[model samples]
Target: MNWDDMRVFLATARAESLTAARGTLRLDPATIARRITRLEEAAGAALFLKSPQGYRLTEAGLRLLAHAEEAETALSRGIGALSGSAEQLGGTIRIGAPDGCATYLLPQVCARIAEAHPDLDLQILALPRIVNLSRREADLAITVSRPKTDRLHGERLSDYKLSLAASRAFLAAHGVPKSVSDLKDMRMIGYIPDMIFDAELDYLSALGVTRVPLASTSVSVQLQMARAGGGLAVVHDFALPTAPELTRVLPGDVALTRTFWLTTHAGPKDARLDRITGLLRDGIRDEIARLEAMPVARNP
Candidate 1:
């Protein structure tokens, strides 16, 4: 019957892992487990089934989840209304996004947000895998593909270009590819085939590459490898600017396009969410424009 217990229950259910719930609540695993136990005892029913994978909601837990979420929404709206003043608005907003976008772009976005709202905190989880918004893993997520669930809302944030690139040193050591066919002889850096989290990141296939000689699960790693003259990589145009020494390979002959989709759970409307979303949209547009204007090096 304790609201605090219910809050813990909701967080645990959404995260499905004591470790993840602990991160969200900033509580120890032992304490979270104890709260769930207390909550179950009060309700006179088991709320969760524990397994190695994580905690899964029991039927009782599932039934109670809806009521708890409704209460949470009401409370959030009340808090927002009470803190209507811009200066008073403050809370942590967790954003989950692909590693490349989060690493290269979101730092600037978060900086601008912090400037506008000094008290608000932004947490960026630059994960390679998909973030589960339905589970509240992230307050907002920037996904390569849109979610098909009705419980979440999303919009196309921006369409960015991808192209083949290599370090100036790599090109100097291994000859530049004059055409797409020449790419077959070059050492290619890319995502590990089985480890690619999203299908849209399968950049090599689109470029007529069926096998990758050098690959990694992390985009950041791939970029580093390319910069170290390991091989050529298909990298985002926006991200390429970070390494000015890297030159585009087969610039005119090869180009791939992908979209970034922004998603959030359908919950209580918060003014802070609106402001952050606007910032994200504007930031991405500016970056895309900058990327479009970047000149690519053509092979002689």
Candidate 2:
């Protein structure tokens, strides 16, 4: 099998588009097509289902993804070792995160890392749902809770603060609640109960909120809803600085705290990955501390 075909296959699978893969690989359209065909022939199965939309991986292709990723990792390590840059951080590292951390923190944290390591490629998969590390969805993931399975390894990053918040307009329109019990009577903005992917994310339930008239699975979206004066939301303290339109509501009475856990597959160790992960730990921790330190406004 041609090793170049594997590279083409991986790129195509990631983008799910021939044109998109061509840009990444810096190759012509015809070359990319020929390579995919060759790879499919070698694998003895149709790797992708072609459509006017884009390439969707077949079941065989999905099964082959794990092996392809392993091969890519191995080649990256081999190339680094041969070039005598094994100790230096280089190569792509995809980090999956819940949108709250991803939206407010990762941009700056990843920018600084990417700036420091000019050769590195960093991708952040910010989703409303939990990132599946076992399927290699991301090389690393920042989760609210630690890995529940032994197949993965986790390191605690830091504990961050959260508190109820609403737009100043919202407070003015619907009277600020003097107590936690008063919250139930007001408009509440929070994650959709059924879509709460993690236990740590079900903040509203712990606060005794059973009905969220305004709800979304995305932290960023919920923040926007609260900012628009829709309702009160349990906004991340670190994220408050980014949305100045929103102000804390009963900080002392309705405060919540959560931990960030960095998780990875519990498999072969790579010094390159280890070095970069150390940088990720420091970057995220410092960012959380910096953002959380910024003063948030409160209703008078």
Candidate 3:
């Protein structure tokens, strides 16, 4: 019934671990357990089913979550309205970002934020599983595709170009392809099912093709596989220079490209969110320019 209790449930449901929920909420374990227990008691039903894997929402829990989220949204609006004039950005900012930002962009931005605003807590939760902002799982997000929902306010921050790359050793072993038609003969490492390009089926389709032999999978795994000289992979240019072993194959003419969007809930304009988003936008702008400067081998 209490807002705090519902928040605890929502966090637990998203994290599927009481310990993780506690960390996100910055609360102690006992307090979180007690809150959830009290909420469950009040609801007269079990919200979660605990098993070895993790917390799974019960049917009652799922039903309650729908209503709880609406309540939270209403609560957020009211809080934003009341505190609209607050002068400082002192609260925690929860962000859901892809692995790229987690690896490339976050450290510098986080360090800057820490030095500039010691009072503001930054929580960067890198979920390969994208969090739904509408549910308040995150206050802000950086994603490749902007949400097509009225509930979100977003902007395309930068356009990212990706190229197929391979380690010299792998290329020497498997031999580089001279044309898109040659890809069928080559062993290719690619992102797993949920990856941006993997989901779109556009990365290859743009080449006027479909389906490549899958040698290895997962974004994290594909990077390693390609690095180990296992096979060719499509990766963002920012990832290329950092990965010393990988060499770009198909040039700018054939590379895959997509835009990154900075998005937030369509709530009252938040100064804190705007501040962080602005910094990120500026930082990535420099990165994109640097990427554009790199030498690209144009396909014949």
Candidate 4:
């Protein structure tokens, strides 16, 4: 019945741990426990079933979740309406993105956003796995592939290119691949076949590479290996600046392109969401142009 109690209940339910809820609410563990007890007493039902794994919602808790979310949304909207301007908007925005993009691109974009809105908290989850927007895994997701579900909204963020590349040291020792056929002789770095999270990431196949001697689920790891003279890797052009010692291999001959899709849950409109989306969209567009203009040296 109490909004404060519902807020505590929602935080605990979502986090599933008293410690996590404590951090989220900035309340002591004892206070959180007392709040949960009060909420359960007020509702006249046990809201959660505790186990070693953490809190599991009871049937009653599951029933209350939908209404709780509605109330939460209403509160967010009310707050946004009172904020009066996009610049005044403040809250956490969790963005899920591919590891490569997260490492090479998002930091600058996030910094720019922070510079403009100091109150906004931006959380970027740069994992190789997919983010489930429907489950509230992330407030926004920058994905290599688009979702097929109707419950989400998505837009093409940008089409970026990838190419085979290796460190100057690696080429000096092992030789550079001159053509697609030459790639067969070189040690290749790429995503682990079985661990490929998205089809768009299975880039080795596009270059006629059926096998990679060095593989990892993390694009950043592949880049590091390639930079260490381990092997040639199929890497995003946007990521090239990070390793200046590396050079593009068979640039024009072996190019792979993929689009990044911006996805979010299909829910009520919010000014904050629109502002952040615009920031990302514009940032990516500018970065894509910069990537395209980067000079690639051909094997002589």
Best by TM-score: 1
Best by lDDT: 2
**Which parts of model 1 are misplaced by more than 4 Å?**
17-20, 26-30, 51-53, 87-89
Give the alpha carbon lDDT tens digit for every residue of 210-298 in model 1.
Answer: 78989988888889999888999998888887877688888778888999998886755666676667788898778778766777664
Clashing pairs in 4: none
Each prediction's TM-score versus the true structure: 0.90, 0.76, 0.71, 0.82
The residue-by-residue lDDT of candidate 2 on 1-300, one tens digit each, is 767788788888887889978876899878998988988888899999999899989999998877887787677666646433544467788999999999999999999988888888999999988897754578889999988898789899989999999999989989999998888899999989998899998888888878899999898999999888899999999999989899999988988889999998776546677677789899999999999999988877
lDDT of candidate 4 over 1-300, digit per residue (tens): 888888888888888888877866899978998988888998999999987788879999999987887787777667666553655647888999989888888888888888888888999998879987654668889999888887688898999988788988889888877678877788999999998988888877877788899999999999999889998998888888777878888877888889999997667746677777888889878877787687766444
lDDT of 1: 0.84
Residue-level lDDT of model 3, residues 1-300, one tens digit each, is 877777899888888887778777899867887888898899999999987688889999999987876787777655555443465446677878777766666666677767877777888877665667865677888777777888788788888777888888887777778877777677776654345432432465455434555533345566778788777777777766667788888664566778878888765554456666777678777766775576644322
- Provide the global lDDT of candidate 4 against the true structure: 0.83
lDDT of 1 at 286: 84
Which model, 1 or 2, shows the larger TM-score? 1
Model 3: what TM-score? Answer: 0.71
| True lDDT of residue 258, candidate 1 | 93
Cα-based lDDT at residue 212, candidate 2: 95
Error of 2 at 167 (Å): 1.3
